[model samples]
Target: WNKLPLAVQTTESLAGSNLWDVPTSHLHPSTNFSSKLFWEPQCQTQLRHLQDRTRITATIPPRLDGHWVSSRCEVRAGPEFLTRSYIFYPTRLFKAFQHYYCDSNCHVPAYSLIIQGKLRLRQASWITHGATEAEHNLQKVTLVIHNQWAAHRLETRLPSSCLRLGSGVQLVPSKLYELFNAKAKRDCLGALHFSMMELDLLRLEIQYHPLHQPSKELFLGDVHTDQNQRAHYRPTGYQQPLQNTMHHIHPCPVCALMYQSSEQSPPILPPSWSIPLNLNGHWISQRCEARPAVLFLTRLFVFNEEHHTWEGTYHHYSDPMCNHRTFTLVASGHYARMEPSSKVQGATELVFKVIRAKVTMFEQTMLQMLNSSEEGSCGQAGGWEPGAEQDITWTAGCGMLGILLPHKEYELFKMEKDHKNRSLLLIGERPTDGSSPDRPVKRPTSFQTPMVQCSPDTAVPQHYSSRSDVSTGPEVSSAIIHHSVFSIFLIVN
Candidate 1:
């Protein structure tokens, strides 16, 4: 009880914090690459056995000769909220547009960058496993300020010469400057020497539909999660995917507007993490997701909108194929939904308080480790056993496992639908540092892996509340979301 520094504190309970330098987060989803069908990790051994039965065919690199637009607002390592629109030419030359926003979701307009470069598709990905590695050469970058407010916000980045053109005052939106000309006017666009969007290590993948219809996806190198190492860290993973406009089968109405958008006449692209009108339902991971920690996991969340209470279960695995069993963390909490964010339009802000949590062990290693712990240290010490679920609330959660009980998190949630109009939960990106966001200032601005909604028909226990005794078993049938087969939870509304 003495150690809970962030306990009982609401997001509104504190104030006076510095603004984020850049909300670029390393919260990214790992892929189960096969014909570009992306899914997260699934229930362990179950998914592993599916992978063992899977037969992979040689992959062909997708042609980079069309328009590609971000399906939704994308958040990178800095946890920066932005959108990308690109046009690739047959000659290998390309023009890319990056729209940066001010808030958590891409509601508030900041500025945009029109970048011209060249891309060359190369060998298969050595780092991304099944992805095709590629290279891109920087050519030029143009800055476009949305309005006076945008210019003022970006004033520090512009050189004095950019502000005064032959006179002492000039309109920033009207005049354009070379962000990285390498010849002149270097000071006009220094967004912390932002990795030029970190296009260095490139990978191109494709999403395959039922009829073998392939939608191209381009994955750029992930920027360093640490702000200090961002400018120099070589990308090993990928950022949020950009979809080829001509090929993408979209459920998003904004997809068309995205194709029509440009820096000069940019469309008001809505938040990809849109919040659903109704929240009384079950949301489960449609696919097992890969974590930067090399852990495969899935999450099941049930929310009672009227009561503002929620329950969540996390299934973690040890292998890439998710065949190895790990421990499960079950948590319950209450959420306070706030009004729309002034900083990010259409984005809902909320605070989630974790009232209790339980831990379930599935393997002997976990049992042995917990059994060897000192008395009253980690979950009742010697009482831990295989396949046993224990309440970690008394000890304020397992310190070794990073689970803090009676905890509160300043979380951001947004929702979107797929081609079939299935709901997806796009929650705030977890911090790269693995710490809970206890303050409103520390709340995430961007999203991580999306959770698919379970149809209302999916049976939810009537007794479910913010209580204990949650069943730790498969909630859905087996399905092929990846090249690897993983158990998925999905039902019709």
Candidate 2:
């Protein structure tokens, strides 16, 4: 015991003092203490002597009670530097402390020591710091121990020296100091150096539960260091499954009716007149026109297959000179397929309704256009009257004939389906009526050339068209019926 280091002696003395002063009454409440026993000097002296004897006979080793994970390690020899990393799984360290009698004599006290499991090295590699002369000579070495096993026993006197023992030491040339005589010289290696080392462990957390289940356990937190000290356990690489549920699902009543109707009896038409499977989707025009000088036109069609109706909204825009004027003409109606006879063939009729036929225009454009009109017809003062500026609004009714009248029948045609590309082509045309000489000789055409399918919830652009003078009222202007060619892509929900 005296041969041990000074630090070891001091630690043993502290442990002895704690043990001698521990209250037996606190440990066992039923036991009573005598007043004389507490105040007697001889009893105190005996307790101190027993503590000293116990300290001399027992040795306390480093505590290895928790789980540990390897993080990083570095080794150096003079100017040479090497580093290694490890991914350690959660491991438990079990320790056993045993006391052995010094001799066969019954009066002899027992000496205590800690017994631990053997540590086996699994892999090793040598690495160089930079491009130096050692790089060529120090090749990375990997050792494989198949069936053979080797264990090296280490006996450390001081637990505080565990860090130095874990690393290794070697002998080298060094100078020794002499107290009384002159200085002496010797060859030795300095203590081992751990330039960088880290050990981490897992941390556990407790959660509240109203009814605790036998098979369930509270979740533990992730691996982290506290005050440069590691923990005991950590989670593995496997992760728990997440919980999720769909929340936003609104079933459309019209779509449900369409499905039922299709299932009852399929519409009979020519093989070429293939109706789109999913028509309850949005469509946008491919080409936009800037007719009427200031007005820019865009056309959009929204077809509700379940309702058997479609709404076409035409968006009109003016140049920046008119404060970027904008308006809309919405024409909504029901569509029915014509019987596939030789007389009518593949034709569809869009029966226009007067339910909500209206035209919206910008206030600025309406004031300017009305001021230049011929007679006082549309309103009290031929239009918006002077001093009634607040009475002027953006929307006006169709009055008599609707905006999309006299041309309702559209010839429906289909192009070859490109199954490889998952697209279908459709073409529709409103034939020339030869009603007005100002009307364009060419027919009005619209198409979904290669309509690619998309999700139903996608947003489609709005359409706008400027009203022709003929549709406004019986007072006709020589404005030609411009053919609008709308190209739209379809998406089904």
Candidate 3:
């Protein structure tokens, strides 16, 4: 806590009192999120096992007993789009509402699940530091189908054993009906192959604002990404975060609308955006993003409408808040014609290629590590210096950094606008397991967080370009090459 700001220290210290009891994985000088040790798939399970040996039950923080609402539509591994609204009682009784949607932006309502249970806080998590471990038991489960379309969609997923899917599904428009009740012993979850156990794992993150309102974010256990592995897998990561209602100030006004409209009926979510006629502009991440494998990053992209060319700059950091710089990956390429996605209703599909790749080391340690790598593995034999950009397109990608040089990726894109009228670019979700979406069958069904386009569109030199395997878009202004002045120009400044 001492490493955080004074505001965080004042409030968070009062909540826990004992700073030593909390897990601070990245706070130590020796801890490096950039290292291979931190991102390994088995590292999370290993940390949990070690922490469980010395586990001790702790009291649930008083501030946790309140209403929490989703700040945005969340995408799970099953590519499920949903919104979560939950309340925690002082008596340890909990009620959670999950509103499912057909589209990634949550415009099309599907159905809703109401889950009531008893939650017990157990211990601190060693994996997602500053989070607590908890267990829960389901008392009741209620499913409310929103419309005929939603009912039809659910019916397709039900196994043959669950023949009760059709009886109560036929309904009038603009009405909600209970399709399944725990008291009825429908065995719907077993038949549908779904589990609500993802709710038991909990993490509370407090964002402090000394001058104004401070807010807390709730991170539930992540749902298994693979549909088949979901039933038995315990969540290791987290889904999208939720903002609290009572002890609240998350800066997103929609959070309140979600809580209010969730009372009687499903809220008609406003500001539903579509792909713009022209996507030629500069788009940047609105905030620092935390992803799987303990990686934290922010992306900046420049697109030219006249040429249909795109350049993406990825800035990687070691800290959760994007305060500590580690390295930068520069990928430049062009996209082909975007066809309407057959799988996802509103998303557009295209292919992105990385004609050239460059890496820039931000720390002296990173430079030394790259210089020590075997010849042609990371880059050239020597001369690796911090801030000096080096081309790694020939060796495919920087081996030391674990970056892959896939020939092309089937990317999905959607254009959206926020309530504030800011243009947003939504890209396909990269596989969390560190695999490339090179094949058509591997195209993403869900989208990542929307990137806000820079207002008035900043101007950058148009030289960097990546060539797609199947060229279908407008002709390029220049030939695609690995070594170009544009690549250096983009990374240096």
Positional deviation of residue 465's Cα in model 2 after best superposition, in angstroms: 17
Question: Alpha-carbon error at 347 in model 1, in Å?
Answer: 2.8
lDDT of 3 by residue, 345-458 (tens): 566888776666677666555566668889888778587876567888778776566555645777777776666767777777666445667788878777666776653342
The residue pairs in collision within model 3 are 333-466
What does candidate 2's lDDT look like per residue over 1-493, in tens digits? 1332222111111222321211111012222211111212322232233223222211121122222211111111121111111111223222222212212111121222222222211111011000001001111111111111100111122222422324454211121111111122211111221111112111111112235311111111111112122122221110111100111012212122212211112111112323434445544332222221112344444455555555554444332111122444444445544333232122232232322323444334344555454442222234543223211112332211112222233333233323243333333322212121113222122222223222232222232222221112111111221111111101100
1 or 2: which has the higher TM-score? 1
lDDT preference between candidates 2 and 3, better one: 3
By lDDT rank, best first, the candidates go: 3, 1, 2
Q: Kindly report which residue stretches of model 2 are placed more than 4 angstroms away from their true locations once superposed.
A: 1-278, 289-296, 317-326, 340-355, 363-367, 370-427, 430-493
lDDT of 1 by residue, 440-475 (tens): 887766566676666442223332212112223222
The model with the greatest TM-score is 3
43 Cα displacement, candidate 3 (Å): 35
